[model samples]
Target: MREWMFKSRQKLLTAALLLVSAAFAAAQDGAAGIEEANTKVRSYFEPGTNLMYAIGAVLGLVGAVKVFQKWNGGDSDTGKVAAAWFGSCIFLVVVATVLQSFFGV
Candidate 1:
């Protein structure tokens, strides 16, 4: 009755203490891992930034060609297509720049 209850409480307290200590140790380990992860992320960031710019440039060229074709053909949707392509290129540039700045990479 009373004895059993006391034993159970003691065991529970001991388990809680062990869990707390393990969590503390894991937190310490995670801090070092976070720094390593940040470095890896930064390494990838530069290459990715360059790749995005390249992709944007290629897209711009393709869009220009398409718009020129549409204009030559006297297509009514030429303006819309040109605007959409220009907007997409701008969006890509802005997003890449924003992400690079945000990550300090």
Candidate 2:
């Protein structure tokens, strides 16, 4: 019985070690893929377009946040502002989506 318990523990330890090693390997591969993608993005080299898209994304996020905040807090003035912001964000997102679809970005 003791020997059986020891064998079972050893098997569990081996399985745990294998899982850890596999996870480490996967993490390394993911890191490498990210680095490769970063290099590719950098190499593509469209600074102006990238900046514009980034700004648009930021604006959209900010607008969404403002909208939610106003909606939750029940501020009338901010409600209008929130609606405007949310609308703009949605519009921007739609435009971005269309552009991405058309341009294959």
Candidate 3:
């Protein structure tokens, strides 16, 4: 009976060791997956930056049209509206440029 109990403990210890090793292997695979994701995101930065610029351009155009209509309508707050729109467009451009430069991408 004592021998049987000793064998049982040894088997349990071996199983635990196998489980730990498998966990470590899984962790290594997760690290590889994370690295691949990082590479993919970095690859997309240039196109993403360009997309931001394009979006900014579109927003600027739309804002300009709105501000022009307000001006033509003789709205008293046209200047304020124009300044707000212009500020937003400038902010977008600056953010994109800064990100590109900062990342060296």
Candidate 4:
């Protein structure tokens, strides 16, 4: 009876080990899939970079016009408005660059 119990425990241990190894193999496959997804995401960064720059340029043009209008109108807050617009344009440009770098694109 003791021998039988020992054999049963050994079988259970072997089965658990097999299940653990299978899980590990599955995890490796999942990791590979994740790598593929990462690559796909990185691929989008190129177009996004261009789009960001374009948006910044447009914002800069619009901001310039608005600031010019304010200055022409003799508004006291022209400087503040110009500063805010310039800051936004700069932020857009910097964000694009940072995102590209962060994604290793």
Candidate with top TM-score is 3
Candidate 2, 6-34: lDDT as tens digits: 99999999999999999999999999999
Q: Write the per-residue lDDT of candidate 4 for residues 1-105, one digit (tens) a residue.
A: 999999999999999999999999999999999999989888888998999999999999999999999999999999999999999999999999998888778
Worst 10 residues of 4 by lDDT: 96-105
Q: CA lDDT of 91 in candidate 2?
A: 73
User: For each candidate, C-alpha RMSD in Å?
Assistant: 2.0, 12.7, 1.5, 2.6
Candidate scoring better on TM-score of 1 and 3 = 3
TM-scores for candidates 1 onward, in order = 0.80, 0.42, 0.88, 0.74
- Worst 10-residue lDDT window, candidate 2: 43-52
- In candidate 1, what are the lDDT values of residues 3-81, reduced to their tens digit? 9999999999999999999999999999989999989989999889888888889999999999999999999999999
Q: Candidates sorted by lDDT, descending order?
A: 4, 3, 1, 2
1 against 2, candidate with superior TM-score: 1
At residue 62, candidate 3 shows an lDDT of 97
Q: Tell me the lDDT of candidate 3.
A: 0.95
Model 2's C-alpha root-mean-square deviation from the true structure amounts to: 12.7
Candidate 4 local lDDT, residue 30: 95
User: In candidate 3, what residue range of length 10 has the lowest lDDT sum?
Assistant: 47-56
Best by lDDT: 4
Candidate 3 error regions (>4 Å)? none
